[model samples]
Target: MLAALATFGTSILSALVPFVNLEVYLGVLATRIGDDAAAALTCAAAAGLGTVVGKLVWYWLAARSMQSQWVAKKLSKESWKRTFDRWHTTLAGRPWLTAAVLLAASIAGVPPLLVMSLVAGALRVRLEVFVPTVAVGRAVRAWLILAGVGAVLT
Candidate 1:
């Protein structure tokens, strides 16, 4: 339980601070836990939950900023409005596609989950879709990393 809490806190820190590197932390954790696959999984779940919660802070900030007058004025420009509208339409119109992309981004970190969280919020993607996709993706990623490290260590 204490380990889980530490992993959760570390994961959140990693999310908020780009240089923290959750993977390295998880690798070290994997070494300590040794061949305890279940423990690895539990830690992964805690980490995943923490990551999403941390990213939600970014999402909330972006969403709130979008409501600001300055942002509204900037978005009022034709080009900016067009871009925003395009993203909004694409994300809102196709929920499954948005979820899939977000999930992939969370797991692969190709487009960067931090950026995706902001994009999702700015575009008003539903939390129902956002939370599960990100949580599952991050959990899967953590599990894979833990498993690989365990394999290598053994």
Candidate 2:
């Protein structure tokens, strides 16, 4: 449990920091946690969660800051609106859809930041969707990383 927390805390940190090279940082963390299979999964999951949280902050800002000059120049209001629509659809159309997408992306080695941010932004997911989708995906991802580590170590 403590390991989970520590690993999760790492996720939060990664989320909070901008432009964290997740693979490098996660690789180092995996080494520290243990080169075992399960440990790798744990580390990945934690980082994934952090990345999601971080993107969520951005997504939230995107929702409110649609009129900012930076937002206008960088991203379109139409795009932002589309994202909210998608997120809402995910919530209404299928409650588990977001979580599944998140988990699959994690297992496939997609940068959680990229995948989560885009999806979350496009979807304009609520805080409710944000929490569980990220949490569950992290749990599964952490397991996968650890399994790989065990395979290599053993």
Candidate 3:
């Protein structure tokens, strides 16, 4: 119970800060808790939930920041607007493709989730689509990490 709560808290904190690596935390937790499947699953779930919540906060902030004069000015630049428009055009008509890209980034951190989350927000992706996709991707990634740690430790 205590470990689960700790995992939840740590995951939330780690997710909010890009410098903190959640996988390393999970591996350390696995080492401490032994190779218990239930514990691993619990930790993974907690981490996933935490990640979703943290990213949502980031998304919200990015969305709101669009109204700021600084952001508006930067976006108004022709070159910047063109680049943004290109991405927006590509993503606007394709929900599934956007979701897939976001999911992949969430899981693998390939494009860096922070940037993706901001972009998704800036693009005004639906929360309905964004939340579930991020949650599932983060969950699977956490589960895989826990499983690998368990395998090595056992």
Candidate with top TM-score is 3
Candidate 2 regions exceeding 4 Å error are 1-5, 18-52, 73-97, 109-112
Model 1 TM-score is 0.90
Candidate 2 local distance difference test against the native? 0.59
Q: Give one digit per residue, the lDDT tens place, for model 3 in 37-133.
A: 8887887788888888888888988899889998889988999889889879988968898899889988998777878788888889999888888
Sorting all predicted structures by TM-score, with the top scorer first, yields: 3, 1, 2
**Residue 27, candidate 3: alpha-carbon lDDT:** 83
The runs of at least 3 residues in candidate 3 whose Cα sits more than 4 Å from the true structure, single-residue gaps closed, are: none
lDDT pick, better of 2 and 3: 3
Query: Model 2, residue 121: displacement in angstroms?
Result: 3.5
lDDT of 1 by residue, 33-113 (tens): 888988988998998899999889888888888989988998989998998887787778788999998999889997799
Candidate 1: 10-residue stretch with minimal lDDT: 84-93
Q: Per-residue lDDT tens digits of candidate 2, residues 44-112?
A: 666566656666776776566656687666545688657655656655556467656665655554535
- Each model's number of backbone clashes? 0, 15, 0
TM-score, model 3 to reference = 0.92
- Local distance difference test scores for all models: 0.89, 0.59, 0.84
